[model samples]
Target: MPSRILFVHVCIVVFLFSVPLAFGAQSTADVPVTKELREKALKDILGKTKELPKIEKEYVIGHGDYLRVQVYGEGDMAAADISIGGEPRSADAPRQGRGVKVQLDGRISLKHIGDVEAVGLTLTQLADYLKILFATVFDDPVVTVVLEQSNSQRYTVMGKVANPGIFFIDYPITLVQVIARCGGFTEWANSEVTVVRKGAEENKLFKKNIMKFDYDDFLEGKKVERNIFIKSGDYIIVH
Candidate 1:
């Protein structure tokens, strides 16, 4: 009887150990990845490989925008000028041309032309318009314009970056280039990035993951959607 009891106890122990292995093998086999399953996994890993956001060519003029205007044949009118007090004046103002303000309405008071709209129009466009306006008084007037101080053109970079300050972007800039300007990411930065832009009614948000692919690949047109062109006043947050 003692021998039989010992044999039964040994059998129970063996059976208990074998039960886990059997179930583990069966469970793994039952969960075999099919062709469809493999494809789905690849898709999830690769993410959406479609085109990224294109760099846009748009700008808005803001306050304290220094402008240099030159009228061919009119030496007095053709000079380096600054927008002071929402008024376009010669660079050599009474007080060294300081304390100038560009109005939100985008209007600049010119000597001959009163209240010229300078915000919406580019420097070149403003020159053409000025030529047309000056043509009424002077014949065959040639006009040239250049931007000196771009106080209103700026973008903000925050969160996880070495330098989280407002950057002045005069022209269109890419996400990778902008990050480089900000001194790269911090140690605890999350791979995901976001941009908040002011819309017509509310703000819009755009999110991207930086860890999945190389930043160079995204900037060099591989994933265009990830290389969005940053606009003035847009905020980039790298969590």
Candidate 2:
């Protein structure tokens, strides 16, 4: 009887220890990723993340932009007689670029050109416009316009971030990078991040495309989902 009782105790101990081992194997097997699941995941990934657009587009000039302006041949007074494009007809390239500021009224006041409309033009286009304006004073003016500072492509970041404010973005930046630029999230910040984009819809008079981005998944370094590019008129809210 004593030997039988000892054997029963040993059996009970073995059974108790084996229970967790058995459940561990079953738990792993419960979520078995079949071929169907893998294909679905692949399809979801392919469908969700479209290729991001190129970052640098031709920037439109707006108010508060510092512009570099240069009138090449005008400095010589007799520019038409001296050079073709601010250089000797036989020379290789042009001269250095100069600058001006777009006032609040969306016009740049140059010495000779005076106030010329610059708000809606690109740097190249502004150069062309300035050339025409300078023609009144100089003979065949060659103008070069370069944007020294831009305030147009800026976005606002608010709510639950360490530092929240408007950020000016020059190059192509992702939403993930935007959060980092705003000093990441606060302790109370959740994964529900919102991006409010303002533009027109195909058939509607006005439209705002609001999207939810998961900063938690973004923090995980997921390559595909974290690549949503920042558009021109985006207001990113972190919560």
Candidate 3:
């Protein structure tokens, strides 16, 4: 009877220890897997911004742009008193020229030249071309073209942002500035962001025309250079 009792007690002790050991092993295996997966996901999300190149191309003219055309001595040909499409301007209109809106046909109407093709030309290129065209009416014509308001270049911001819509950008703007202009992130938004660029070349640096950024890491001042300039026709998606 004593031997049987001892054997029973030993078996109970062994079973108790083994049960805890099994649970501990299972917990250890699960914890590391969860941690590793989380880390990998974070790395994948933020790593895509590492190789983005800076965009520094000149602004090209397009439809829906506003232009300020100035002639050295000619006021009638300027954008001051002349509305777009040759419409009459009000007397109280500002003298600084509210600019001529580019028509849907990618052309702007001038006093002497009539409709001039303004799309696909840089500001300087347009200015030089105007000089050539105005040479018929004036001796050694001096002309300057300023991009007053650019309604042509637009970008879309969607997903988890306060204001998700298409926004116009006149100048080169960074990612942070774009987010701020869009009213920042929503309450359920994560720091992960993806940018879908339309004209991005497929190379080792870019994949599937997509780029990612971690707003939290950027806010912490890490990878500041990855806050790339937002291009026209780009879609910014906040996760």
The TM-score values for the models, in the order shown, are 0.54, 0.61, 0.65
The C-alpha stretches of model 3 lying farther than 4 A from their native spots are 1-56, 76-97, 202-205
Judged by whole-model lDDT over C-alpha atoms, candidate 2 comes out at 0.68
lDDT of 3 at 168: 71
How do the candidates rank by TM-score, highest first? 3, 2, 1
- Report the C-alpha lDDT of model 3 over 1-239, residue by residue, as the tens digit: 99999999999999999999999986763353454686667668769666533435668998877788878877536433534344325322222225776778999888788889999999988988998999998987778888876677888888998877787775679988988887899999999988889768753334788888899999899877768888888888999
Per-residue CA lDDT of candidate 2, range 1-239, in tens? 99999999999999999999999986864485675886667767767565433335578998666676777744422112212224323211222223455667888776754577889888878777767777888876666777665655677889998888777666789888888887888999887788777652441312356666776565687535544778767788888
Lowest summed lDDT window (length 10), candidate 2: 76-85
Candidate 1 local lDDT, 1-239, one digit each (tens): 99999999999999999999999986764474665886677667767794434534434456656566656667535223543455434222221232223456776665565566777776656777988988887876777766656777777877898878777665668877888888888998855566666651332223232222245465466755666677777777877
Q: After superposition, how far is residue 107 of candidate 1 from its true place, in Å?
A: 2.5
Leading candidate by TM-score: 3
Error of 3 at 111 (Å): 0.6
Best by lDDT: 3
| Model with the higher TM-score, candidate 2 or 3 | 3
TM-score of 3: 0.65
Model 2 residue 236 CA deviation in Å: 0.6
